[model samples]
Target: MTTLTYKADHHWRFSPILWGALVVAAVAVYLIFQDGVHLMVRWWQRDEYSHGYLIPLIALYLIWQRSDVLSRIRFDGSWVGPAIITLGLVVGLVGELATIYTVVQYAFLIVLYGAALSLVGPTAFRIIAIPMLILFFMIPLPGFLYNNLSSQLQLISSEIGVAVIRLFGISVYLEGNVIDLGGYRLQVVEACSGLRYLFPLMTLGFIVAYFYRAPLWKRLVIFVSTAPITVLMNSFRIGVIGVTVEYFGEEAAEGFLHDFEGWVVFMACFGVLFVEMWLLLRITGDKRPLSEVFAIDSPQKAQENEDTSARHLPTPFLSSVALLIVAVFGAASLAERQEIIPEREEFVTLPKELGGWRGRVEIMEQIYLDTLKLTDYRIINYTTDTEFVNFYSAYYDSQRKGASIHSPKTCLPGDGWRFNEIETHAVDGVTMGGKPLIVNRVLMTKGDRRQLVYYWFQGRSRIITNEYAAKWFIFWDALFNNRTDGALVRLVTPIREGADAAVADERLQEFTKELSKVLPEYIPG
Candidate 1:
């Protein structure tokens, strides 16, 4: 018998490269602290992003699992790493000036990846690439992209959920996202919009894919399948809630059970993912047991004594210097760029009468105002002898951060009003500060009641109909003019019991003509 003995070598030595790397990391972290805080706070508050907190830990654990392989690779420092770091800093500077936290967060990850690449060359980077790529799941999607995705997901989930409810022999009426179920109405708000499941599940699927010792195609399928699985499962959850409400009353869909149901649904999503993997394995004639699928055992633990040589620490001096310069520049830019809160009269005294239409001012609840985060707003019920319309204008002095305008497409569904159609309508021969004015013409209905709404985003010197276009202008204006002032101006009129929508349209169009004249005074076009 041969006896093999291995020495456990443990040593701590601070090299110049290590110190340089630490200094660079410390400076980078310090510069991105504000963005980091905002992201963590959002993770705590937003359920969709709650999984963000665990992504980094998981990534680190993954790297540790492959430590043996990583440890053996010698660091071949590259100048490209410094170049990437410079690009990341430039991105952070742009985000800081624009007040877009998402950009900063993304830049933070880029800088982190660049730092790793700087210390270890391309070979080592490829070895630990998955963990670094996993960092992307931590950054929240930009607001514009999130809104569009949420809208589409909400609609898809709502449609499928309603179909499920119908299959259960429940009498259901679906208009947009509102489900009318005789006794209880279900509005598939943002929470029920599938994003609550998609984000977390996508993160989970990525992790599972990383661990799954399978063919590349199998792993890819497992990861990409999370989206549709999330959507389908969320829709099923909604359907289950509908059935519960039908039998057990609305209380079944609220309170503790509701929260529990969400957990159960998420767990079900995990089960579905596993089932998918199993089926794929069967299709490929791979007979590996499910238990044997995960590659969780650390390679370093298995082969520790095989190698004990100390490799020289390759300090990324160029990258470190570049990062330091960028951090300093970013901090200076942020400190110097003042938030331009342009002076404008408040919206309190909008007017009692406009274009011969009498108006009555109404106040929004404090809770709504808090959520809106607008600098000022005005809500008024304008009426004439034969027509009544609601005029609302919410103003944000600075929209680069939170408290931006909410699209009616997102808000109206929550109020049990289902939008039937929403399209951009160019209001010919009308102008705001002598520019073409376009508006989104929306037709919404709640049961038998119908309403016609016309709304547009009023940014400085622009009357935009598209919400995304408004976001673009906000970014451009924020960068060029140091201003992100904008307002969502909406006019809603009822399509009276027997009256045609055309009548309501005429009333809103006439009111808008008068509105365009005075909006510049308060909104500061």
Candidate 2:
């Protein structure tokens, strides 16, 4: 009896003091990461990130399922916990300074990891580590990455969807991301990019892989197969919509039918995952029933004779909590620091006529306005005797939040344009900051239509051609200059049918020279 009692006492159990400390730590974490958490929740409202709402609950469930194993381990806190917590705090500070909430969101996860390690030490932490890592699925990708991914997925889905349509003995033409089916045209927009299914199915696959009783390689296959499964299933759904629309008119692709098709495809993806698992099991010579192969054992109950002594709070955990409290104060201080928005002329004041070119201003639709979230913008078509150029500029007073300039490289591809060549070119006659103007020069095509384009990012007296460099400057300026103001200046000209592309290039360069002189007034150095 004495030996049994001693063995039971060796096992760690949460006491009232520990529970109270956990509650305090939770509150501190909330206070420190409230802004990022709120933004994450807001992102959950979008279809692609809607699965975020379930990730936390699933993570908790995973931990709860392992409680039996957790209860057997002793809580010997390690100094590594405090070190990790310090690292997390430093990362959070950088995020706060840069005003990038995505960085702060990741830092929150890092701090939680440290806090968990501080409380339970390395032994028990290993048991719960995967579940903790799973929490990362809840955060949304950065806007630029998401746009680029969505564009690629859109193009893939469109091509596959058109192929599926052709397999049905129906004629279809594919140009970039658009599917032209004689009577009707279908543009594979961002919503149809398969990401909505990809994210949720990937999360589900990860959880399934954790529970699956199989060889390591087989479990990995189950998880990784989710991507191709989602893409193929989503493409099939699109193809089915096209076939239906061909017979039943445009109504087949709108309202309830379109949404119902999405649901069906997502369900089909799940079915495919299960089928793949079964195949893998067969290949491995496992003849056990599918139900038995995927085990989710109930947590074991504690013995009545176990020790019930109250455990003291660990010093590492207390230190972690103290660090979080300090972070709360730091975050509050950051919130008090207001960003500076410099005075600049609105795009409406931009000159219409310049350098012997006549211009016509164009109004963007409400959908684009909402998506761009620009403070001001100007879109105009400038024409000469035998040449024409399209000019567009977007400005943001503050890019601290998610609303930043969208790169033309990403946006153009989504609009059914394929990039043929991309390079940096310096306009000889045009200058910025007493240097030759350098811009991202691109030759893109959609079917037979070819266009020559030039664009660059202007911010904080810096002219940047690289998208990543622009982002770095935004972070740098936000931290030191207390400003995130920026603008995207783009010029485009169509290469007339059977004409040399060089003429269009010359037209854009000439127009760029004149436009550069006037842009400083609106975009500001």
Model 2, position 521: C-alpha lDDT score:
84
Tell me the deviation in Å of residue 380 in model 2: 0.6
Q: Return the TM-score for candidate 2, rounded to 2 decimals.
A: 0.95
Q: What are the per-residue Cα lDDT tens digits for candidate 2 across 1-525? A: 223222443445789889998999999989888888999999999888898998999899999998876776667666788788888878887887888888989998988899999988777788899988889999988877887888789889998988888888988988778888887888887888899899988998998899998888888999999999998887887788788877777875664345755567778899998899889888878999899989889898887777655666888898888888887887788778778889988999899999899999999988778767889999999998987889999999988677888899878886778789999988878887555789999999988899999999987899999999999999998888888899999999999889888888888878887888888888767
- TM-score of every prediction relative to native: 0.87, 0.95
Candidate 1: TM-score?
A: 0.87
Candidate 2 residue 186 Cα shift, in angstroms, is 1.1
Per-residue C-alpha lDDT of model 1 across residues 1-525, encoded as one tens digit per residue: 011111334322345666766686767555654654476457546788888888889888888877765655556566777778778877877877777677778777777777777776777678788887987987777665776677678778888988898887998988777778888887776677788878889989998998899988889999999999999988887787788888788886764236745667789899999899889888999898988986578664534345454445555645566556657665865676687776777888677788889999998988667556788899999998988989999998887654478888777775668879989887766788788888899999988999998999886888888877888888788878888888999989999899888887778888888887787888877
